[model samples]
Target: MENEVQRPLADFPVNIWEDIFTSFSNSDLGSDKLKEKHITLKETVKESFMASRANPIENIKFIDTLCRLGVSYHFEKDITDKLEKSFDCLDFNQKIRQERCDLYTVGIVFQVFRQFGFKLSADVFNKFKDEDGKFKAHLVADARGMLTLYEAAQWSTPGEDILDEALAFSNAHLEEISSRSSPHLAIRIKNALKHPFHKGISRIETRKFISYYEAEEKCDSTLLEFAKIDFNLLQMLYRHELACVTRWLPEAPNGIPDSMKHLYRTIIDFYDKLEDELEKQGRSGCGFHLKKSLKSTSNGYMQEVNWLKKDYTAKFDEYKENAILSSAYYAIMGVTFVGMGEVAKLDAFEWLSSHPKIRTAAEIICRFTDDITSYDFEHKREHVATGIDCYMKQFCVSKELAVHGLFNIVSNAWKELNQELMRPHSFLFPFLMRILNLSRIIDVVYRYEDAYTHPEFLKEHIVSLLIENIPI
Candidate 1:
């Protein structure tokens, strides 16, 4: 008995045995071509057992062996199941510190069983389901897992019954369990529906309702209410600030305001009242004034720009104490906030584009307008990244479906722009593209480092392209 026990493991040095086992565990071996028919299952099982025996749990290589073997559960089920038992028997956790496999691996294993048409009971799956499970990461990992299983199921022999298992697994997890999760799980469910092997799965139909902003559901009514208040506050802030900057109304024969001093104090008093109102609402003065105010202020600044262009000697701050210089300085601070707000709006738009179904073009424009009105541009990249992560996780395998819903946004924008052309004071194509590019730069920011931190980098690249009529 001792020799029999020792003999199986004794042939291999500990390192070689562990290496062989690790390779088997981690590799999706079924994905590889099975060339040698002579090596039957019995033979393969015998070889695997021999390798495990040689290394043993006490060997230094056990942890690496376990990691690979855990991964191998995807490909070599018989070997893995048997190995699982052996490890359990040895109380391997006591022998060597072993982290329970990653939750990602759990999803992958479940996905593998699913592709083979194995229908695990709901009770079995509940073992792993938790609200806090790295919900976003699982979405991406599971999508990749499903893709692999799909191909394998396709190639397997008809009577092998793997396809049934795959369908059953998909149904249980995706249709049954996934549909019940909160809409926040939309990104993951979307991706899973796109899984190539989803032919027999019926649950794909249920994902339509699960999203951040479904047709029947909106996230927060309070946020919507606050948005309107925020918009009004912003407009007020802009008007008050503009009054402070432009205290000098030209003294004309019939004009009412000749005293700049009196007007300046009135403007300051108006701003203080407006500030109090904004404070009472628990909103930021920066958010209230940044976006709309910045744009309108920019129109004013353009006049200054034109004056400076006509003559370099033009004094940008000619009006002292209460005039041009004060306005320029304060306006610059407001514009900085506007710049950040523009960045955030752009990031949100890119996210909408990536998941078109969730955000219709009309919805995208509406949201853009809201952001512009509110000027909430702080933490632009972080929001985009987090949003993308949500998208990838929610719609992991169903990216096309989510994207399909988004097409109307661009189409609608085009339609609106065309209609506006007939009206006077409409936005021109260049101006539209320039503003859109401000949003487009968010997409570019993630793709290349230059666009994220540097505004001029986008400006130079885009302006050159615009000048040359280059296709973006």
Candidate 2:
């Protein structure tokens, strides 16, 4: 066989971004003044939670605020307890039958319940439908309601036609309202349209929401201040973690490039320690299986290198098979194996190795969205053919059509992911959440653009999540 021409070099250079973490100051992090303020605000928030216990509506709103502000993890127990109590007291049937539920309350309550794994019927939304069985047209004017409805719809399972309808209906009206809305409202709508709250990374959403909420006419000053303080403190902790990782980069194995070695070694070391811990706990089989899973994840990088060396456009199916591996979906699954219970870890590894539909769906979302946004830059470089190239070459379609087809693939993949999430499964919900969160991160980073490769769009998130401290 004749040797083929090597792929041309891409215009983009290797990731050469400066180490922003090196400048982070440890002394300034978690200062006495900040710690005192954090405690005061935290107590205030906790007191509010106690006061709201008598009012389910107030309690739900408080829980929703914590989630939106990205501080819910700090109060997980309190929020879970409040939600459980509220769920027990509030009767969905009576609330709907008595016409006591508005779109905002119903949307919030439904999303909270579903998010916490307290199964609720999609029929809660059916009351909003008119006699003709369509979402009430009057609801279109309420942008808050529409946005919440749009987010709540993301929890829909298979055969839930009402949620499907809610998604389409709310999306259209929200898009329309965005054009004429106030500057802040318009931006919020635009962002929600691009990345719904349900599919957004919590850290990124909190950073964005802090600004938006601050600008609201009815914004709670205490909550706003507390959110800012908490965000900055959390960023300090993340900075410390990154610094610790950076300190160990020089110890990574040979052969890997300096640029890539840190991340690869970090992931490997995490699993190595986890495996040791599992063995110490007498879960030797689970530890061995997890190590095997890590090896499989490493193989994915090797597969990508092999594909790039070939330098030919593959059919869509062929590209998809390889792309899923190359997209690092397995790495996310492997990482979750750490700290898991023995049976859960073994079962998760088995499910992950089998290439479940949900994993494939998430990989498709990651791979296609990346290809769609980065197509031009990638095509210019020495890269393997992407979904765009495969579809175009196989069907003789235009670039535009190829991109549209790939988008359809991403959409279908999301539906598959949503379906898989709702179905009963043997694996723990936390393990499953790792997959879902990976998909959500893809939506945040790749929607409308390749935020990861470009990095400019991600600067705000990095700064807010790690570098900058909010003013007291």
- RMSD of each predicted structure: 31.3, 4.3
Off by over 4 Å in 2: 1-8, 13-16, 52-55, 85-90, 97-100, 251-287, 297-312, 336-351, 354-357, 392-398, 419-425
Candidate 1 global TM-score? 0.18
Q: Which numbered prediction scores highest in TM-score against the true structure?
A: 2
Each model's TM-score? 0.18, 0.83
> Alpha-carbon error at 43 in model 2, in Å?
3.7
- TM-score of candidate 2 against the unseen true structure: 0.83
Candidate 1 worst ten-residue window by lDDT: 200-209
Q: Which pairs clash in model 2?
A: 10-381
lDDT of 1 by residue, 1-472 (tens): 5544221122211221122212222122222222132124324433544455543432212222222222222234554454355344445333222334333333344333332223222122232334653122243345434433333332222233434454345444554444455555544455445432222111111122112223225333332222222222333343444444444333322443646455545645554664465445443453344333334444445554454345322221231111222133233333332333323333332332232221122234332222222222322311221121223345463434423332333334423432222213222222332333333322233223333333443454333221221110
